[model samples]
Target chain A: MGLQQPSFSLTALAAVGLATAMLCAASTPAEAVPSFARQTGLACEACHTVFPELTPFGRRFKLNAFTLTTKQEISDINERKQGTLSLADLPPLALMFEASSTWQGKRVPDSNPSAPAGSQAQNGTVEFPQQLSLFYGGKIADHFGALFQVTYSQPSDHFTIDNSDIRYADQSQSGDFLYGLTLNNNPTVQDVWNSTPAWGLPSMTPPVGLAPAASPLIGKLGAQVAGAGVYGMYKDVFYLEGTVYHAALTGKTTPIDSTSGSHLDNYMPYWRAAYERQWGRHSAELGTYGTHAHFNQGGLNPENGLVMGADTFTDVAVDGQYQYIGENHIATAQASWTHENQTWQGLLNAGGTSNSKDNLNQYKVTGSYYYNRTYGGNVTYTRLSGSTDALLYPVGTSANGSPNSQWETFEVDYLPFLNTKVLLQYTLYQKFNGGSNAYDGVTNRKASDNNLVMLGLWTNF
Target chain B: MKKVFLAAVGLATVLAHAASAATESPPKLAREVCSKCHGPEGISQSPLFPRLAGQQAEYLDQQLHQFRDRSRGDPHAQAYMWGVAGPLTDAQIKSISEYYASRKPVHGAAPSDPALAAKGKEIFFNGLEARNVPACAGCHGEQAEGQGAIPRLAGQHADYLYRQLRDFRSELRENETMHANVQSMTDDDAAALTEYLASQ
Candidate 1:
């Protein structure tokens, strides 16, 4: 039983606010742009098992900074006969568009306070153009390349910088190893593995679907900061990378001020290490990555406007992937788990939370199978759990003030062309916001009420 | 005597430089570019790409020419090799072909099913009289070590071999001789042959 006769107006505002805030941190589907195919003169299959998942060759292509081009080039040489310039005759540019329709299991309560009893909002949503993106995704020089994207979402109605990575790479003279440097705005945007947060499974989701309230800071910060790092692969087996990040606030003043919400206090450090092995038609990879960050909570003292104390977050994760690519069938399984340690000293001092220390954990596993790169299906199971804080996760949204949720997603996809994909995805939630029934405490809403089914068409050219 | 010694040293230096320059590009290209997919020395680990090591030089040359000229209209040829071969000069192709052909060929892995291998061996060495199929070894050699412009089938990836046979039969590969030889071969027969060839 739940409090069904609560203040409808207040509950409606709180629900909308929570949903809107959560949407900003939800996963944005990763993409495999066609510019790389055009630049290298290779078909999409040469680099990907499907559009966004990498093959061994695709991983190597990214490791080389996407500069392996066979296209005609305009060239120049210096006086010493050292090459000074080499530019592709055709610019590496591409466009991607996605449209989708989403249906939720149950309609939400109407926001209008004067509405008749049992009135509900619409249960179905159609987004004509869920997202449209332009990409510059290939070589710029002999050893430098970039995958830069600008995207427009129907919800936002404005174009903004999306996931972008620019890199410079070269191989050792002995051809035994490769090393590169990357500058990117996202923590795992430069990663080559799908097991990483930036490219993980459930490649796409409805823009407005309900999501867990808490996630690791490492997975949440994308396009909000800039990072530079160096990575290397030895004998095509071992991989290692390290990077440091600083705030690159968007739509903000030149110099960050109090207006900017909680931001990186100074810099955050991120690192990754992985090992891969390939034999015959099989490949496997195991990896670990983590980040440590200190944040300025933006709480200022009233007297002098001096900044208050800071909060800290440390997140570490382990991931692995196994791929079997037969002549006609391709199968892949990947799993990742992340543990976060949070110390909200600043927020605690400001009375924003009931506890100064808490922890959260997320686990995900996905398995997929495809036949001849044409039709495929995947299943993903995700679980999230964290220590409860009454003030942090209040009663209306989280019945028990606990951040615990679990869900499973199943998706089937058909690709008529390598660049075009049609997908149907369904998500079932076993628990949300700490409970299955009356999860939100005030609305008599069940976790299953948020079950989502989405049909989408995505293509890039 | 001093003048003669100086002349001899200068001639030796010139010859050495010319020899190095003449042989450099192919190995560099092979190591840096082709090796990404084909693996070093063309012993590719993935069945999606074919092994080029120990292939007949003349065959490699002909294929490269076909790829560059868009005459090899197979799906894979159009998708992968056309753009790669387009920019190569004839000399570069010849040198690259020779470089791979000189490398040691791959050794076949043991077949998973010995019975399948045995059937394939029989077909490779003897004709299917009822089906009017010719013995593959008549042209591929007793050991499947092809000669001149014929391709070596021994130790090739089984999947690659099977697909090529299918393409030839379907005329997708546009090889009159190969199509004539494989047109009547059934999928089972092709599978057996690939198994046997892959096991050498």
Candidate 2:
């Protein structure tokens, strides 16, 4: 009775709020958005807080292999009614586009000598249709499904495979346990929740200057790695997973390229553990994940003669997320901390480092609130600090001998339609490269001068 | 910065007006027109009328469109929903479905026979495989808290469930898979199962 009391109260509150809104006729009309809604016949609210931020039900849908669908299907049946070749009659596809304009607080000093005078620096710049993306997501077979994404960057003028996660899953008799295997091209690409770096807050942002240079290596190692893992849930409460990753060379037919970053000394191993609880309108999750990798740094300098040493790194992270979904409002908060330990054996052997060990730590926290899923805002604070080494980190350029910096971002979003969003984001820098003033010693650039504001439009079909 | 602030305020005002216009449209139509048998919030007092509260919006909307087009030809649907859904515009149907989906479901009383309910629970969890019946939990959720377009069966009306299951078995309902699934189920089984589901 005690366990059920809160749920009843939550339902009552939601009913009151919904009834009031119904009487007031505050909801907008419905329109088709994407492949998921088209195939499942469910509205976006069943799965998303906004766009990619998932609700509890969304997490379940992904964990179940995304095979649940109401679309027309073709299949060959066996004795037990097993599907021989199950496929959707319609191919699930969607197109997405984004446009943005960026404004920096101060003009950046021309750092490139090849740049022309007029092309040097500006306070504002706009990219019409900054990015165009294609997505093929939904059930692929009876027990298999995938979410694949490809993007074309306007600045680069190139198309590349971005993120892909394919899965095969099954459930137990009583439906209390679910198990699955995943094959993904990125480290956290297969993650179902938004608390991780793969799908966290600020889902979209500009690749502007003054962004932090030193991010934890865990999130950076993706895109060039091929990873495989197995995961399972116990009664939908406890989850566990382990994966191994290998360097995968892209744009080449060969398995390894010595000149590319896709060269690995050994396979990296990653592990995850989480516990989730959902009751009433409140849901929470606490989890830990980590990865260990060793890279051969000899190929970094082919002219120096191939050295036999390697740089080893171990990154450990912990994260938490909490969400409250009322009838008219939704609130979410997420936090994560990562600590990376690196041993510069190859760099030390090459006379590039004075120390053998270095450590980098990063922390991020964000909170968001939405009203009627139409208008919302969020704030985020992020900090990065690491051991100082003058030899390892130069005193000039973007970094200043120390990997220490802090920044905060505030963003407001408006959704005129369910598939369209307009957002404004402002960033403030408190510290950069261990100094608040004259962080870039060469140009005497202050940390506060790097502040930026961006306006963005995102839409999907 | 000031320009940005002013633009935000102006956009907000326009959006507010747009939202107000929507309120005057479908929600008013839903409340004023469709609240006769289905209550304002979609909780029906009569057992003959199926409770629409907490049903999936997608499922509800699909059914309304089907009824208007004569695609769903079940006796009850033909007798009741045919007339009700005939004149509903697409916008009105969507709004009514959304309004009903947002309402809270009401749990009914327990079965008069607890032993029969226990047997029904067994059938719900572990289907009578010898009779070729699949577990209801496989499609509906563990607690019958449906997903996607599936309608929630927990706390549904016993009379409605019994009639639907019987109709499915007799080919009176047009669902082929459901007909196959319930063909092996007996009248006693359907009665017990409905009682158990209604009490959930």
Candidate 3:
């Protein structure tokens, strides 16, 4: 059967919207919650410079599968004196709340076409609880643990499974090497470093905002697939990991068929390698990671039985981080660059793209400084560029059939208590969707028109 | 007489069993859990964690007890130690303390600044008379090898020692003697003293 007409002919702008929504939803703020503190009997500083940004010790904590505990446990032993059951007296459960208000530089066009000839949506939006999440994190068994989250987003008004990483970890008898296996729902969700896409900078941003039309495939697949991998660290310096992913759609029938949304035709493979060095109060890491995937646009045509071919994407990235942790001052800097190559065989077969192959590159650099973990600020700059393909990035969103955008983000954070934070963030766009002005080709929209200011309160218990 | 003999035999067996249990579990716990941060032999790699090897058994025992009872109110103690010490038994604490104290002591790395080390050595041996600061060696040994209930300062990370001095001065650590000793000390004095002690 040939490719389905409706699925293949879906406007590039719609596809971009879907991708952007998924990326934004998936990048919700991750945390180092109080439950972990209760389990380990260690303070938040032991594992984090700030919430969500891990220290060397925190990285090790995750490498060990978050199984370290100082809490009392109910236990049992077998005839050979081997432990059979070990359950923490207190469950590792935590709840997080995020409330935010966002102001756009200019209001967007009202989406309701039946309204007046000229209309605009409200310029400011408030989410009483922008997002609420419940987490079950920490040791699940002797050498197994999990950090699982279920989130309720205000815009969606529903609870859905979020990022999750379950692991089985162990160390060598001589304690020279550490190794683990992970079953996670998202790429880089199991990674210890924030340089990776999943935990990268701009950690918190407004949920509803204008975003770039194109991103790497790896950045868009979070929570839509499942992966299993093995990872290891040698001498606490070198790290290596490999994972393979398959489609695992939520709220969808098992053994997916053509009716399922976009899904992998076969397992995607992801790999990572890194080297970290520590001396005194300074720590630095350099790493490279990549993924390759083949996806089938699932749908059936009235004439053509099914969409027949798969589109392939190969993504590779290099990242680095440097940190200086002092008694009263802490500083961190991170940078990353990603390259993606796309082959749209299935889409081209259905006349979806003007070009069969395209390429994209993204670069980001961020720096942050905090004093006593009480007050901090962060600055980040990001640039993304890709090949021009008319049918792939059509008019309405991309005037020049190109996906090029650049922006800078500035944020200031205040913490009155360890578990609570108040933050103000601003984003300024330089170029979006190929042009600074008339970017959408349908209206007099300027790249700067999408600028955003957001203020938020985040806390967990 | 026969009943008395039987009772004595039973008591001796019980004592032996308790001794064996005490000896066996502490090492396992030390290796499996404590070693994650404090290093396998109690010489920690991170300055965030203090080296435990060759510390005074009495000091270690006293501190663990304080942590368990929530009396040691330092930020790190509250964050990291309270939970760990919460579940520890008296015997476990005693065994763990002795286990760490018996290990080989750490040899401090060379001081980053020799001048600072020299100044610190002076402050260690002789009181900072102008500032009314007492000599550190008076209570800690002349070699900085501390006595009972006094922490050994030699070979500890300079960063760790400096923070501890700050904590003591602020009374966050809540030790009357330590607070009195460090209250008059300035930042420069703390830097110098920690440098010298770390180079020991």
By TM-score, the best candidate is: 3
Tens digit per residue, CA lDDT, model 3, A98-166:
889999888776655455745666778899788888999999988899999998888778998888999
Report the candidate with higher lDDT, 2 versus 3: 3
lDDT of 1 at B9: 46
List candidate 1 stretches off by more than 4 Å: A1-13, A25-27, A109-121, A299-306, B1-26
In model 1 chain A, which range of ten residues has the least summed lDDT? A1-10
lDDT of 2 by residue, A285-319 (tens): 99999888876553445565345477778989999
Ranking by DockQ: 1, 3, 2
TM-score of chain B of each: 0.86, 0.83, 0.86
lDDT of 2 at B130: 82
Off by over 4 Å in 2: A1-33, A78-80, A115-119, A303-308, A398-400, B1-200
After superposition on all CA atoms, how large is the RMSD of candidate 3? 9.7
The two-chain DockQ for each candidate, comma-separated, is 0.20, 0.02, 0.19
lDDT of 1 by residue, B23-133 (tens): 223376787688898886788888888999999999999999999999998888988898788888899899889988998898798999889999999999996777767
Query: What is candidate 1's lDDT per residue for A68-90, written digit by digit as tens?
Result: 98888898998999767889998
- By the TM-score metric, which is better: model 1 or model 2? 1
Q: At residue A439, give the lDDT of candidate 3.
A: 87
